[model samples]
Target: MRPGGSRLECCATDLRPRPPPPPSSSPQDPAIPSGPSLPPAPALRDLAGRLRRLPPSCGPVRLIGVDGHAGSGKSTFAGRLARALGGAPVLHLDDIASHEELFGWTGRLLAQVVEPLGRGETAHYRPYDWRTRRFGPPRALPPAPVILVEGVGAGRRALRPWLAALLWLELPAEQAWARGRDRDGEEQRAFWDGWVPAERRHFRDDPSRPHADLLVRPGHSVHEGYDVLPGPAGTAGQGPDSHRT
Candidate 1:
């Protein structure tokens, strides 16, 4: 609500390590640990290949939605994944959101970005400037083979049907919010105070996890890569409803 109403035009990695087998109880067999073992993470190349092969979700573009709580490393992870996909274009939701309409920019996105891309045309949007609290000149996003939409509510119900695959960062809200608050620091403390409740309310009413195709867990180190697991919504190959347009 900075200037435009609800219709405002605004706006991966892989590592695998095998643990040594547990000591054998008898000479015949090794005793497995009672604790569950996580499946090996897919290589980054492998994940990229899989994503590239998905059916186009928006016209000629495979619109990949990378959704998660703020400061959950969605941007960092999406950057890596975009590199893996050979420099896919990324559209940050931050560019679409204004201070006044934190989670209310859905309609603007659909009209300015999604609709044009859906019709195999270039999408132009004016990115929001948080500091100035105003929108800048229009920017263009061509329909690429793969385009990543990364932000907090990328997987909201309204946008899910158009996603080739929805990815959720598997980080708890408290920890994620803490990281966000710290990153924003004391200067933006008041903003964070308002943001936390708004984010909570948004998720409570329209949770994205239940509709995510994959849950991405970051590794401990930069080179360690990420662990990707199937989410409650569906697996990679199982397409969501495509007829919805």
Candidate 2:
């Protein structure tokens, strides 16, 4: 989502709720590198090329999802991927989620963003103001070839049906939560305390990693920042024209 005006809220830990780690082992997508030595740039380029060629999953758009544990670096990864896609529009779930709704904003998402895009039209949704605890004016999101949905629940069951690909940021829960807490600091400590259990409950019931087509692990290399591994879904290696329900 565009980051102009008062839309900037204390988004530090909203999506960074911590949950227990899910299972690790799964069938692999042979297209991804198995070793730790794989260069990150080429992998991301390959992913971008593959995604660009994929058939649109929602209307005229190839809606890609970047979902993982809070503070797992979904936003940063999504921004880089968007750049790789030549400035594809990114819809941050933070704009759709509110203090009252949180994960309960699915209906609003469908009505405001998904449905319009599915109908080959521009979408407009009121971004929530976290500080004021109110929603602002409607912001327009045009239908781009590859639009990214980035946040904690970007790959929820309700949205998978409309995604060209779902990518999970591979990071353990405790580690990710620690990173989130450290980033947010004491100011958000109370919020994180409540968010942890809520996030746990959400993930325990509706997990995203299991359904992901690609698993992205943060790379230690400063230049090449991420390694895109095969996810449990095993569909990552398929041709761009392939489909997944």
lDDT of 1 by residue, 144-228 (tens): 9889998889999888777888888888888888876665556667777788899999999999999776777765444455556
| Full-model lDDT for every candidate | 0.69, 0.68
State, as a TM-score between 0 and 1, how close model 1 is to the true structure.
0.79
Candidate 2, 201: how far from true, in Å? Answer: 0.8
Clashes of 2: 1
Clash count, one per candidate = 0, 1
> For residues 1-245, could you state the per-residue lDDT of candidate 2 as single tens digits?
11111111100010111222112211101122123443235445556777787778789998888898886777767766676577789888877887667678899999999999999999999987667778899999999999999888898888888887788888888877887777666666776787778788889888999977777776443333555555677432433332111
Predicted model with the maximum lDDT: 1
TM-score of each: 0.79, 0.79
